[model samples]
Target chain A: MLALIRSEWLKIRRSVIWLLLLVSPGLAGLIGLFGVREEQPGGPFPWLIALALMTALHAMLFLPLLTGVYAALVCRYEHAGGGWKQLLSLPVTRTRVYIVKFLFVMGLVALTQLLFLAVLLLIGTAKGGGGAIPWSELLGSVGRGWLACLPLAALQLAVSTAWSSFAAPLAVNVVFTIPNMLVANSADYAPYYPWVQPLLAMMPHQNGYDFGAFTLPSLTLLSVVMGSFVVFFLGGWAYFARKAV
Target chain B: MSLRILSAELLKIRRKFIWFLIFLGPIGVVGLQAVNFGLRYDYLVGKVYRDDLWGGLIENVTILMVPTLFIGLAILASMVAGIEHQTNSWKQTLALPVTRTQVFTGKFLLNLLLLLVSTTLVAAGTIVLGIVLGFGTGIPYGVLLKACYYPFLAIVPFIALQNWLSVTFQNQAFPLTVGIAGMVVSMFSIRFGDWFPWKWPYLINAAKEPLYSVACGLAFGLVVLAAGLAHFVRKDVK
Candidate 1:
């Protein structure tokens, strides 16, 4: 499995998709900085809104698409130049190959999230001028946001693998972008929908951070992650195993 | 030969990414807005951002800037037929009896249809959002319809550009990347407002009147579309 993953990683690196993936998050973060209103010489412009705006802007442009693109690229490698058939010709089981690819995509997602967090921290600290870093708040937001993306990442991977086209996964991402935004703002049933959890966890308040409104209970995150993992893995496995290649 | 070629072209489109956007994009937008309305009602209610808060809110929520939705469509449309060149599918497609004109038309029509469907979804999402936002009293149906029409008109140039890019580039990423980059640039450019016609998909919702004279934009769209078709018909797919 490790060898399979390593080979997949090598293929991704060779394809240049990995480099594209690494650069997009930072580019998106820089774009967010462009929209940031420099704190009016006196003080911050409502810290919560500023933070929320910063987080939401980056999340809106980069996070979901980044995850979708990463997932698609990983799955796309197998489809490129008939890489899947050649890989399957090896002694490894189909299930192991699927698992390894999925893990790799998820790992890439975590890395991007960390990159986003790092960018946010660097910007926030620099702008805040030696002020106490809101470490707990930032981590909380990052944790929740990253956790919320699991289901989406799973869905994107399933779609990309099943369709075997970059456009298909991209279309799926485009289609969901608005709906996900609206769903994230809903109060009644947002807790039930896994997609909204990340945005909900990042909501702002009057002072420092409104952790109360945005925090996702561990149980909910656990349930969502477990449910998505099972569904996504089984779905990918079933489609890849049964489909005529 | 023409029928076989056209059928093959259609099949490629069916397999393209644009289908997913056509089917699901607007539905997601509307559903998300409904949720946003439910949660942020307090903040939204009785709020006025200048004299046209209601209109402003409607525009902000309905605009394509929600998250790369419009740009994604533009990129997909621009690259749909072009991918054939990248994957060597065009060589196979051109080998059939069909003339280049037929193949180009088929792909253009398909791209147009996808764009239309996405626009319709955005329109529907906007209506649903208006109701959900508890501004049923404030939103004028005419304004919403007008706003929706603007995306269609504005997208004409984008569709044209996509067709042009696809034919010019053999690699699929070339067209897609260019289209995406164009959209990001437009976001900054349109902020100036005077360059609206060249903005290629005017941000109607954000405009003061939300409707403008799109004659120049329409002319540009037609010119580009005609030029793209002519180029495809004259150029060899190889």
Candidate 2:
């Protein structure tokens, strides 16, 4: 398994997809730096508002879309010229290969989260007051955002691996993710919807009326997120194992 | 030769569900509102944008539709070129008597035709949804027409760019990555000015003299189309 992961790492080491991953953080950082203003003198954690506002779209739409794009790009090389057949003929199980590749994609998504966090820290120190930053809230929000992306990456990887055409998975991702803007507004649907989870997890709801009986770290939300991750990851793994290629 | 190539291009996408995708773009945009009004029709109509309901609804749809149009153009362009790429038939197709210009032009014309159909659906969908929701009988036909078609006109340059990118690179990810990033930037470009081509769709709707943006899209699209053709003719198809 380690060797398989190492080989997969070599495949994505020097690809153009890394630069693509930076886009969301880069854009969010720029918007946060210039657009947000100083809070009132005695506010509690001014940086929280800036961080939340900046990451709203990044986590909601752009990051998940980036996940799909990267997953597709990672599988793109193998999909060409019957490479899948050649790869599967090797002395390894398809399940192991699928797991490694999925791990690599999650790693890339984690990198995006870290970069977004770093940019938020930078803005906090530079433009925001030299006051004490809410490191826990910031990291927790971004961490949960990454958690929200796990099922998405799994699903996107499955779709991308299933389709040889690079655009197919991407188009599907865009079509599904665009409506997050609407779904996140719905109290009834937002928590359970995979695409809207990141926004619900990241944004600090004011009324607290939406998630009645459930908080971000509530057992129910965790089970839902983890359950989705398990289902998609295992489902994709099963398909790859039984697939004709 | 041109007619034959155009017919072939059209035939290639048959049974591919590309038409479903074409109409799906507009329906998705209006469908979001369908849900919004369906759930909260009384609240929305009673509280928000009651004056000139048709204009308000159109404006709301356009806000989300710009990004959809931009992304849709990229996907359509990619799907067109992707057929040849997936089949490994680009070199074979170009080797025929048809000029490279005709091949590229055929794809462009098909994309334009699809987008026009999508725009019509959006216009028609908006009107239907408005009537269903009882937003009033006053329909601003001119505003609705402009809202639907003007963005299509303004998106011409992007259509050309996406096609060029898709045709030039065998990998569909490159063009798509560029298109998604362009969509994000265009959301912000509405603040900068009219110079950014990504924001042309929004500018056309928002500009004081909207004709200028429409003119920009038309002129820029023609220029890019010529440039893309010149590049395609000289490059080696692998």
Leading candidate by DockQ: 2
lDDT of 2 by residue, A63-100 (tens): 88888888897797788889898878888899888888
CA displacement after TM-score superposition, residue B185 of candidate 2 (Å)? 2.2
Which residues of candidate 2, in runs, are more than 4 Å off? Answer: A39-46, A128-131, A204-220, B136-138, B204-207
Candidate that would win on lDDT: 2
True-contact fraction for model 1? 0.13
| Model 1 alpha-carbon drift over 4 Å, by segment | A22-24, A38-51, A125-131, A201-219, A241-244, B1-79, B82-87, B93-109, B117-145, B161-238
Per residue, candidate 2 scores C-alpha lDDT tens digits across B121-219 of 998999999998887778999998988888889889999999999999887877887888788778777556577787778854445877788889999
Interface RMSD of each: 3.7, 1.4
- The total number of steric clashes, by the backbone 3 Å criterion, in model 2 comes to 0
Please state the Cα-based DockQ of model 1 relative to the true two-chain complex: 0.26
Instruction: Assess candidate 2 and give its lDDT.
Output: 0.82
Count of backbone clashes for each model? 11, 0
